[model samples]
Target: MSKSSHRDPLSDTQLRVKALESVLLEKGVVKQETLDAIIDNYENKVGPHIGASVVAKAWTDPDFKSRLLENASDTLAEMGLSGIEGTHVEVKENTAELHNMVVCTLCSCYPWTLLGLPPTWYKSTPYRARAVRDPRGILAEFGVKMSENVEVRVWDSNAEIRYLVLPIRPAGSEGLGEDELAELVTRDSMIGTAVVEMN
Candidate 1:
């Protein structure tokens, strides 16, 4: 078969980012070493695992969970997990009666320190518009099926604050330790696009 002519949009986006980086370097707007260090930090040093650790702690400790729900920014900062785009964070917990999802309707304002970077879908115009219009449909697309009895709440993130979803602790997780539970928590789950499954 001949190679397809269609190009991947993500590849195109990566190329654009590279071009922008090159232009910035040429203009001396940013140093290559600075860019490299920032990339290294996001790629190797920081990611969703930090948020996963917090979720695991909340799962294991009721007191911490209570505090997290009451005041997310302070609670998260207490663990030294605060930074730009994370200064104001609100956490919503998933329960039997309600499911929480986060979306930046205005733009892709997200908790980068905790969630790494927003997924391309999260930053798309369609997702921003549809998530609020038809959350259940969006959830279904994300492979999350919910009963009619459960309420779906879609929170709009903005410049003032960002949201995180505290996914429900899955069944059969009682035997797991904090570290093990953290492994089960995924970036999508925390974003409310998916849930944590035992498998």
Candidate 2:
């Protein structure tokens, strides 16, 4: 049968998508598990693991945090993690009187090194809409109740650069080391949904 005359099982986009899917499926099958294993391998093993490391380093090393705040790309590369989109990352610190929240108003632009994969809610229309309109209320839903006087500044990550929130370190974590501090920097803390609190 002529190519044009035959029914194509896949369109151009479908062909590309299927090709990637097949590779991922094969990788998972070879690893003797479901696709989730492969995803977990990347999420837990490779992707954004560097970001967690960076957060840890920043927590301990003041010099590194200064460098990261000055220029994220250089600092990240210095730590041997680079090449993701949004190499231009801006770190915003949340203080007691001022809180900062990050959202990709146009799309889900995030610093993957520090944030790993974007959560479903991060990309949802409801979050995108509500984050800008009722940021405090949205944060409240996640159990982060800010003081009435605290100003909430919502940042919209655009095409140029991505954002990572530096949440205020918990009070009791005064003597914590880098490793301990990293554990406190939850994804919610970075996203401004919750604050980092010591138990």
Candidate 3:
């Protein structure tokens, strides 16, 4: 078969990365099981769970909440959450009057350590543009409706920094423990795209 007639399974750059990974694996510099473990962690244990843990701690601990609001990245590190994409995190608290949202105008720079990979819509150009131009409309599209009196704040994520929304604790959740509170937190809430459901 002609080379041109068959599409390559991997892109040239992707193939190069794979080749490098293979070499490292063969040399025992990187174990296959370790690689699989890392993937499994990101696919399951990491992502919103980490963010939710942080949020729940803040909701349940006043001092920790103050520390998180004052210096988020350091606080995250204390919790064993840090990565290239999450080297810096800034928490934006959602209040009765102000609602926060995040967008990456340049690219899909995100808190991968806390949210796994960026969602497709979040990485799209339309989201980047529309979020800055019409945040309320975007929120509405996500089924997040707020009164006109509420203000919408849009944050831009870049290589240097990322944003996480500290959603308001539901009124009925006051008796909940940190773990229970964490259960109430959601990926969308961490991304400022939706509110954490109380129930």
Which candidate ranks first by TM-score, i.e. highest?
A: 1
User: Taking the tens digit of each residue's C-alpha lDDT, what string does model 2 give over 111-185?
Assistant: 775677788899999899889899988987888788889989999887778787777878888798887777767
Off by over 4 Å in 3: 1-34
What clash pairs does model 2 have? 51-113
Candidate 2: list runs displaced more than 4 Å: 1-42, 46-49
lDDT tens per residue, model 3, 56-93: 99998999999999999998898888886888889999
- Candidate 1 similarity to native, TM-score: 0.86
What TM-score, computed on C-alpha atoms, does each candidate reach? Answer: 0.86, 0.77, 0.83
Ranking by lDDT: 1, 3, 2
Comparison by TM-score, 1 against 3, better one: 1
> What value of lDDT does candidate 3 attain over all alpha carbons?
0.88
